[model samples]
Target: VKRFVHISVTNPDIDSPFAYFKGKAIMEQTLIGSGLSYAIIRPTLIFGKEDILINNIAWILKRFPVYAVFGDGEYRVQPVYAGDLAKLAVELSKTSENIICDAVGPETYTFRRLVTLIKNRVGSSAKIVNTNPKMAFLISKILNLLVRDVVVTREEIYGLMADTIVSNEKPRCSTSFSNWLEKNADLLGTNYVSELNRHFKKINEDAGYRISG
Candidate 1:
């Protein structure tokens, strides 16, 4: 029997209010009930050469002198490397057992610490400011208008604050976030990556891509 590999989130629940979590849960259920030998890979934050969140954070840090931290920023995140995740997926794909694993890195950092690390790695002189979620979301919305891209979403804020992106399971990936950041700091946020332009428009038209409904 051919095995099916599904990439999912850290904590997925059918009753989750956030569409991301809820949708992932629904898909997991659909796949599990499909009677196929399946392996579910639930990764926390995935960071690499082409990641959005970390790169965007670096981008904002490079441009803005002030960086906003929603709430106290005590939330924790466990980021797994994209290469490690791919290797795990490939290894599991060759198996016939029904398994579920959390693909997480070796280190866990508080939100504040994570941002500070990135700031240092990018050599940014930005000041980190703690603000309420509402204010942060508003700022992100304004940035969305300015950049013509979804900078961040309210759901993303909620999920981050709720600490839903961290996993308690044994770390399954070996890459260190700090090491990766140090090596890629120069190339991290030199250019802003637009999700809409990458997905909705042609790659060649990125220079003048216009968002349309």
Candidate 2:
């Protein structure tokens, strides 16, 4: 291949306790050492039609009377549009230089502010409550059981609290999340998306049928 483009998370660290971040870091290192012209596109939160985070946040807010904010919720996030990230990856693949860059959006928002914006746009009356991360995590576990899906992970909370997703580099994508949300607010969170069902359960079911055959 002339060039390889890899999608990775922002501020990934091999030493990170979180599997998601650690795994990304490991893959990035492996690719970099492979002696290929590579471009590593590190994105923060990516929002689009098939997104989990923003959609789920809207889902929770629309259904629940109260929403919890873990810790002070001041940590910042820079969300890039999925389309924009994809375009950047395609653009980088044509280049021969080994490059590493952040693919963040045009706007940044604090965690609390982001939730509140979603709340307003979705026209939800849920009360935003600030709670300790421990309590929030416990609640997430309970919700996970109720929904039969992973609501939130402890590591995700830790990453959000650390503000690891935001970058000091200039925004590389032009799509504004807030603007996109304005147009898509009515459709978001109308249905819940299940990670297990979308990924693992299907694989398991396919494997079972293959074994039976």
What TM-score, computed on C-alpha atoms, does each candidate reach? 0.94, 0.94
Candidate 1, pairs of clashing residues: none
For model 2, how does the per-residue alpha-carbon lDDT over 1-213 read when each residue is reduced to its tens digit? 878899999999999888898999999999999998899999999999899889999999999999999999899999999999999999999889999999999899999999999999999999999999999999999998877888888988988998889989999999999999999999998988877776677677877842111
Which candidate comes out best when scored by TM-score?
2
**Looking at candidate 1, what is the lDDT of residue 50?**
89
Steric overlap count per candidate: 0, 0
In candidate 1 the C-alpha lDDT for residue 128 amounts to 97
Scored by CA lDDT, what does every candidate get? 0.93, 0.92
Off by over 4 Å in 1: 202-213
In angstroms, the error of model 1 at 50 is: 0.9
> lDDT tens digits, residues 58-133, model 1?
9999999999999999999998999999999999999889998999999999999999999999999999999999
Error of 1 at 125 (Å): 0.5
